[model samples]
Target: MSGADIANVCNEAALTAARHNEEYVKLHDFEQAIERVIAGLEKKTKLLSPDEKKVVAYHEAGHAICGWYLEYADPLLKVSIVPRGQGALGYAQYLPADIFLYTTQKLLDRMTMTLGGRVSEELHFNSVTSGASDDFEKVTGLAQRMVLQCGMSPKIGTISYTIDRGQDMTKPYSERTAKTIDSEIRRIVDECHERCKNLLIEKADQVELVAQELLTKEVITREDMIRLLGKRPFANRNDAFDKYLASKDEKGDD
Candidate 1:
């Protein structure tokens, strides 16, 4: 039966019990049932293995640190090594904010964050693994967003180049323009990869520490991040490049 039908049944039962002077039958039964269901689901949350959890923590910590450090991205909220549904392994939560326009530097920094997790794995494990599958997906999506959605692409010009039905895909553009776009996409990916590599290299020690904390706590708070880093990266971030970072830091949520 529908939830409303069940509620109606409960209501009738409660009214009958009340007529017989039974106690505690006047409560909001539906709300109480929903709360119990929610609590049960919450208790069923899954977790990762020790090594995998550590990997997730450091991986996400890398992104959080890079975000706070860049001064152009969003401030780090909570960092979790906890495994979520769909084999997430771990996740880093950032404050959701709108992006109207992106500067070249901001776009670069975002790409760095998207790839930060995979780079962390390579740095820590002395070898790469499939744990970064998600990172690759995120990076690809970010690159496409930059080139196709955000117009940060230099070759495609300020206008977006999109596919429409009955349009030419084989002869999409001049051979020269097509080649230029390919070059631009590669440059964008290469530059972001380098940025992530450099950031991870510089924070090599902190990365280990953060990963260790994840192994211990399964989740790292913003305060945990600050304590591990000794200072916030947002403090000295570039204003023009990291304006959003500073703004999020100021608001101080998550």
Candidate 2:
């Protein structure tokens, strides 16, 4: 199910590999394309110290472990500490659902995963760092969307409010309702963050093991994850991806 955008990236990566005298574009090229699409190209930052790399490794491992346990989360496909994009010391990639309607639990799972890295840094180092700035931004936006757009808030109760930033319409809700919405969003985010922290603490040993692997190997694939963590017990069992995989298996048998 390669979309036009993914195809474009893979083509670009393939062309670059060809220019470099590679006989064929390997799996590595495709992975680079995906990472590039999502996070821009890998940065050429100065090498991190042993301590810094450990912090990053555990941070990313936190995300992967959280995704592993959350049934509604996208599958944790791969993880790396190759210093991709600006300010990202590491990242975990997941296979997301290709649907518009996001369930409350699913959204909550996403926020939990988003905050997992920062929570990990706190747990391991007893302090936080600026590395989780993007995570915080994403978590806040998602939580706000859950409250304002999706009306997943019990307090808001099915009212979708849009701020008319372009001045096309008045801000959709009254000042009091807006305040309530903001409060609800904060509550949602705080709950998700606390839940994520607790999960990381509960699975501390597994987190440490995954980070140790990342330290040994800077990049790891889905198979590597399966081997390292056995299997994700709570992977979402229903999705279009399941049918797609079944079809592929059928085709391969022919």
Question: What ranges in model 2 sit over 4 Å off?
Answer: 1-4, 168-172, 235-249
For model 1 the TM-score comes to 0.69
Q: Please, what are the lDDT tens digits per residue for candidate 1 over residues 8-49?
A: 657665655566686766454443333333222122456456
Candidate 2 to truth, TM: 0.88
* Ten contiguous residues with the weakest lDDT in model 2: 234-243
Per-residue lDDT of model 2, residues 1-254, tens digit only: 46888788888789768877999888777777778877667777658899999999999998989988888888777899988766667888778877688888888998998898989999999677788998899999898888877868899888778664695777777899879987998899899989999999999999998899999998887778778777668444744445677899999999
What is the Å distance of residue 239 in model 1 from its true position? 12
Of candidate 1, the 10-residue stretch with the lowest lDDT total is 34-43
| Candidate 2, lDDT over the whole model | 0.84
Best by TM-score: 2
